[model samples]
Target: MTDAFRFFLTLLDLAGLILLVLYFVQMGLAAVLPARRLRFPAPAALKFTFVIPALNEGLVIGATVETLRALAPEAQVVVVDDASDDDTGRVVQALAAQDSGVSLLRRTLPQARQGKGLALNWAVQQLLNRLRIDGADLTREIFVIVDADGRITPELLGEASSAFADGRVMGAQARVRIRPSVLSLAPRTLSGRMLEQQQDMEFFIIRHLQHLRQRWHSVGLFGNGQFMRASYVHEQFRQGRLAWPDCLLEDFASGVEMRLAAPDHRMIFLDSAVTQQGLPDLRRFIRQRARWTQGAMQCLGYLPRLWSAGMPWLARLDLSYFILGPWLNAVIVLSLLTQPFRWAFGAHGLILDPLVSALITGVNVVLQLQWVARYQREHRLNTGQVLFTLVSLPVYGFALLLSLPLAYWNHFSGRRTWDKSSRHVEPGEAVPSMNGD
Candidate 1:
């Protein structure tokens, strides 16, 4: 074996070891970090306007509206139907008629306008205009944006409203729980578990790190349930030039803009405010992840601006993490694949002993289990759902690997489209059983 090949294998092994250690460390942090309780204000005197952007959500629209009605009866609820081919409009109209607080708005996309960002911009514009005409104070009205598939308990809304009362808090992000579904294929089951791991890590670990640095500015805004001050959003819209910036990742771009424009405006991740949403089936899940990867790469230019714009050390670190994390995964995978070839051809047999590698792998498994247990407990996931995580790791790893090239290709080719995911439920219907899969 050549010395060069041996050196390369050694480097690869070291890199893998480091990543393995980091993964465990991240999991440990997630497990032991004391949960922060958001101080929500009394809801009696506060006014909230819930804004939902629906594009073919006829199935889930009714249930969401009803949930909101039960949770925030006094608050105004506006449903923006984004020219759905389905009966989304009719459902909202019926719901509006039944509940006076519920208002319906139909947005016919003009020739040039496209994407959820556009739909959101139109709805928010209408909201601002209505409030202005009504002579309502901008600072007093809370605006909540929920995804069409979003399921919220009554307590979630109240908790979100309470966070708004903090004055400095410009936005509050709710905890996202992926409702588990049964899948026949092992790959599909693994993919779902990987997603569950991501959610747990985001809420428990990543979010804490963000808060500690005072730069916890962004959340899963791709309509992961969030509430913001109407006035703040309006101000951002005007300053940002384009309403949603013609970007595939509108939520992320908006977060960057908000942080830059208002440094002190805190965005809280309300642990108690939970939203139940579906995980994509294996195929759609890959597509969704590819879109995110592409979007993140395209927005790399914004990182320096975010960093230089008076963000705290922790916030800056978080930004760097996202910008480089995907590539790091790619590197780790490549290193793992090439290690054996190098060992056979090179002088260095293996830098790390098999026992050490096994120990590292075992640690990784334990950390994953800890996260899965915490996630299942908090979200009330069933035993089958909990077991799915254990089964999905390799499948997710493969998906991650496949998504890298596709994301880069789309980025350079300038292929940005509103690749919307389909909703699985109908208005007022129970969540579909995963067992059918």
Candidate 2:
């Protein structure tokens, strides 16, 4: 092998190992990080406005609005029917007619369906306008963004209320959980069932990392169940800023902007979660993740601002690592592709020894099992379900591995739009309880 090529291989291996070590370090931190305690306001003390951006979510929108109304009967539920070609607007309007708390903001063709961010911005402006006219305290109003498939409980709002009790907190992300019932109700083959469970397992890991991020006060939004204060939203709007950036990952971008906009402002992680419907099949899962990966790539431009934002160093590091995650995967792709060439040329690959590589893989598997075990215990899964989850990890990892490149391909090929997930569950299906009862 050429000396220059050999040196490049060595660098790739080293970088790959470094990234692996960082993952383990984060896993350790997640294991030990304690939840933050804060003084929370009473439920009646503050107003909550739920902004749900619906785009052809006819199957799930009605159920979602009903759940929110039941959980927070006093809270304002604004459903922005983003020109859905279905009955989304009609469903929400019927609910609005029944309950004054439920309302719909119907958008027409040109303005609607542009992006989730635009839909959110339009809804927030309407709320702000009414609140301003009513002479209400904008700071005391909490705006939550819910997906049409979101199933949240009282705990989600309770945790958010506690976080916002600390005046410095302007944003809070409710932990995300994949609804198991979605899997049971949907007709699926064995592989499809496993794929759905894998998606749920992936969410379990995400929730764990969110806990660790709390230590750095760098919690981020999941787009489905994130909350923001009206005062903060108004401030951004007043400065001619989009409350939520018009991007694929508007939720993530908005979180980063919140941090950069004010050094003292914080985003907290909620202990409770907002359960979302699971992906019924592999195609939807990959498409969803690829969209997220591409969106993360889109967020890389904020790294410069993040560094100079005067936030805590750990917070900056954590956020930067997240935004740059896809780029790191690009390195992994190169390392894998060059392994055959390295072996043919009698040079070392990414990992020098076969046994060592096997050992590393084993360790990763054990760690994954530990995470799965915790999830099993928390959700009270049966042994078969636990085994199913364990078996699903490889499939899950493979899907993620595939998604990074797919995302890169899409980003460069100018294919930014994605297919939204289709729902099969009937509206009458019971919304699963928070504790998995």
Candidate 3:
């Protein structure tokens, strides 16, 4: 039994080692490889339609609409109010009445609040119909999805349009940054500040990884700040496979499908950013991340299609690794949980030798420090914030680790409803969960 446990520990160590090596190799390649180039068309020539999904987002939806309209006056903004019992619909309707470019799609009871994917899909259909009536060139039109709390700079639409100039590119995801003002709502404490900084750090790392993935043609969408071509969306609509309403991570599932749909299909990571409000508290953060984790696990259904997509082996490998992450984490968690038993049975030796463990630890620390350095440089963080971030990263990591087991439990227990996050709920108020996705 002792030998068996040792073998299990050894296997876990090897799996973790392989994952670490893969991460290093990808990061190295991304750093050394030339940037994936694309042609930029005049921003004036591109027609953008921004789709914002709202569910009881009365507080911020007005600002989001106003910001997008201010940034791109010529662009059409469509806000789909998913049966918000609040003034969400009225707020958007007022905006629509004030500007011809703004429109509101109100979903009623029974069909409302299904999922974000369905809301987006419904908005696209309405957009296509309106465009068709105007005899618009669908092929040249771009559809951008923005969350209700999302804000984009003036350069966002223009920068995003640059990718579509490359005929091969079908989708583009803008870099996502957490807005600092939202964190003001959190209690004034070191932990609260750490939460905000760590979220910023998380998005920065995500952007960097997306840049790395551009080489592998495996870039993903974050729901907010995601852009897709209208013609491609039209094609999906006609084929009855537009947006996935059931997947918890509808954005990710749609991304995978986009890649598999065509050989030349490419998704780029945009240099422009869309700033979003972060969860002000840990409870909301965990709920949001658990939903994301479960969504990734649900995406395992795409494995058969992914393997047969005829992508290069490396791309397939990268994607497979991503979709299979929950299972891998589960194994690692099992290893951690069983360590006490191994110690009890006198079978607790180092999974890797002290020297090897130290090397891995050093490499991880260096890589993380590199990320922090980049974040600090890009965001102009002071020394104190940098040091605080470095210290709090482990806590953030442990928080993410906690989400995985909860996600797995929820998945197995058939808890698939969407638990909406509230930015201004009072002390003990429960965030509401809606039907369907």
Candidate 4:
């Protein structure tokens, strides 16, 4: 029995070493390979339609409206109030009454918070109805999706429009980060503040990697701050495929569909275009990410399509690795942690022995620190914050690693309800939008 267990442990170690090496190699290639040179035309005088799908978001709705209005006074803002029993609809209705550019689409029971996908679909129909009445040209406009507590600056509008000038690119995703008030954090709320900074670093790393994937002309949309060409979205909605994604992670599923719907249709990641979001409670964060994992797992249904020769091999390989992440994470964590026990029990030649694990951990941290040093100007992490984040890597990483198992539990238990993320955007929590390097 002991020998059998040791053999399994050795197998896990081998898997972990392979995954670790593959991960770093891919990241290195992405970092070192010179970006493909493709010049986009200058930013057009593009009109934008901002869609905010809200459910009981009264606290932050008004501020969201004000910030967006400040950024683009001429852009059309549509607030889809999904039957919030609170004053969410009322707040937006008043704003719509006051501002000519702002419009409110109030939805009641039988169609409320059914899911964000359906709520967004409802808003799209209303937008289409409004546009048809006004004789607006869909081809000349862009559709931007923003969360209720998210903020965007006007500068991103022009930069994103320039990306869409290629005509082949269907979507553009902005770099998203969390920037809660550091000074206003009370002793009890310090954990939340710390978590927010960690999230900011996470976004910085993810956005940079996605930017690298652009060299292969392969990119995907994020849930918040997704900008799409209006004509394509309009056609999809007309065909009834754009809105009714069955997965709880509608944003991710929609992104995959966009990639598979046509080879010419592609998304781009814009590091320069940035969006700031506030962190929810830690408990809600787990629920949110578990849903994300399941959503990603659900996208496994699209594997056959992604593997088709129609898609680029680079994108196909990336998707396969991403889908295997949940399982690999468990192997990686166990292999790294159990090496000492295995060695003490007469195990030998393990791929992830204690020394090797330490080496891997050291290199990973050094790479992360390099990212911090390069973008410290944009992230604004202090000495204490940096130290705390360095120490907290395991905690943050384990949090995601656990999600794979949680997703399995959700699937096996037949619990597929969408638990909306709790919103707590207090006065000081809304971060002012800024441009990224």
Candidate 2: stretches off by over 4 Å: 39-44, 181-188, 340-347, 350-359, 426-437
List, residue by residue over 250-274, the lDDT tens digit for candidate 2: 9999999898888889888777878
Estimate, for each residue in 25-59, the C-alpha lDDT of model 4 and write its tens digit: 77667556655655788766678889998998876
lDDT of 3 by residue, 367-395 (tens): 88888888888888899768877988997
What does candidate 1's lDDT look like per residue over 158-221, in tens digits? 6766777778777766666555343344654555556645544444544444343332444434
All predictions: root-mean-square deviation over Cα? 5.0, 4.3, 4.4, 4.8
How close is every model to the real structure, measured as TM-score? 0.81, 0.92, 0.92, 0.88
Which residue pairs in candidate 1 collide?
41-162, 59-425, 59-426, 59-427, 190-392
lDDT comparison, 1 vs 2, better candidate:
2
lDDT of 2: 0.82
Considering only N, C-alpha and C atoms within 3 Å, which residue pairs clash in candidate 4? none
- Give the 10-residue window scoring lowest on summed lDDT in candidate 2: 428-437
> What C-alpha root-mean-square deviation, in Å, does candidate 2 show against the real structure?
4.3
TM-score of 4: 0.88
TM-score of 3: 0.92
